[model samples]
Target: MAGRGDIGVRIGLSAVIFVLDGPGLSVLTTHAQEVAPGLPFGPFDPTRHRTFELALRAFVTAQTGFRLGFVEQLYTFGDAGRDTPRAAPAGDPARQVSVGYLALTRDALAPPSADARWRPVESFFPWEARRAGRLPLIDEFLAPRLRAWADAEPGERRRRRVEALFALEDDAGWNEAAVLDRYELLYEAGLVAEAARDRPEPPAADDAPLLGQPMESDHRRILATGLGRLRSKLRYRPVLFDLAPETFTLSQLQAAAEAVSGLRLHKQNFRRGVERTGLVAPLGRTTTGTGGRPAELFTARLGAPEDGHAPGLALPALR
Candidate 1:
């Protein structure tokens, strides 16, 4: 619904480049104008680029100085009732649609540029990391606040949504891949800093919980999309190998899986299942780096033995 002078559509590109290393799980982010960080982002130049993927790769490399590999389109985000405070309001009246891509790498590297660096995924979405079992943030802090937020509204659906998203009825029912759902719920309830940034008016209550670290613009939403996509992709695609070392011990592989999935996997079940799938083969050598008895080293065999089609691993959670 443009009156007369709307610039119409503006296309931008962003990357959610993730890596697993000593820091556990982390994503590459460039310094944003505000205190928060943002995904590598730039406008898509249709004149210079033939494809969206190429444009994404070009800017991500320019901003982070690290070329991307094993990337996939995540989702497109539109500007609607979102506050991009330091944004280019100059276009004064143009809608921006950012196409986000998920990039996975085996190692974390120092971005050749000073503006970009790797930040732990937990720093922004700490609640998503549940591999260690119960989180006090969920039980003691997040639940009560979210329950209050739901109750303040005039609908039973809100309460039901809270119960479903948080799995308050059954702790074991929590879905790790629903990162976007949970984050969107939090944003809707004004329990996060981004909520405050977006809303022009003051918060409904002074005590509204400001949970998790914030990101510039809607980059966090894009990140939640990437995280959720990665979690879900693990079930049917061998994308985890893109984020694994060239060679690693079975223990290391399990640890990487646990880090990404945010679930404490059952050791015996995980090992048996992985071995059964023929997704990995032992190197006939052992590594003492695990700080215990020698553990056998293994390499990822991305393709299945039968059809050469790679399938994702099954996570045997320690329920």
Candidate 2:
């Protein structure tokens, strides 16, 4: 029996969580008044603003003093009571729904303004570690509980869920783009602290630290949405260019792909694939100072198709 006023208006606000490569996959984040001192909150106001996109542009510029580029919608989260309690204004019945977005930009830009940082994404979602080889944490911690859930069901449905989540059929493999699904599954099973509700006492600290560090609020979840989108979109779009340097060696490009995808890629095969996609062309430049070998420089092809007009370079299979 909700009235017209009871129903919250659909408000859109864009957020970008950039993945910066250094030692690992890092997320660029900002601290607003809620998370940091001496920060204004009015910049995020959706009302009296024409579009969330414009608001986002102003928000980032105000907070970090850097203009963002190559942006896209990440996800929309509208779960009731999801915002921090302390920040909710009195009599503000409207649910604070946030429309998350992701963007890829050059890392050469200066560090974001104070209270913002680029923290390793693994710091928040360690279960995403497919970098080394096998996911031992998954096999040890999540598998037991997941199997139990599957066991509760009777047949194909159970098998399908198990196979999809664990990537078990024929030893198939893990897919990194299922970030949101994986988090939701973990939440449903009470594997993450955020999933806990109506409990008299908080659950004990998880012994398995496979999942990354939890963010201040649902920022981590929003980040997962962005990561999933970027991982999938890069396969069919040339958006990877946004994150690349103006000129890069093939190895550098490969490394960027590997960092974003969270998987190892074959060197020769990856280069061949990139060349075949017509996404990059040689810049008639070569550098021999990369230590032991000479490397040719290349740049991403200009005027590449946007919104899936042209096929993107095929990424090497994840190992």
* TM-score per model over all chains: 0.93, 0.84
**Winner by TM-score:** 1
Per-residue lDDT of 1-319 in model 1, one digit per residue for the tens?
7678656777888899999968388999889654688888888778999999998888888877899888899888886754442334553566778888998987586889998999989888988878888787888888888899899989799999888878776554878899999999998988888888888874677554577779988999999999999999988787878888989987888898998998899999988888877789788998898899998888987654577667788898875
lDDT to native, each model: 0.84, 0.68
Q: Give the least accurate 10-residue stretch of model 1, judged by summed lDDT.
A: 82-91
- List model 2 lDDT by residue over 177-282, tens digit each: 8988888777655667565542356545565543455554466677778888888887887777888778889988888887777777788999999988888989
Count residue pairs with overlapping backbones in model 1: 0
Q: lDDT winner among the candidates?
A: 1
lDDT of 1: 0.84
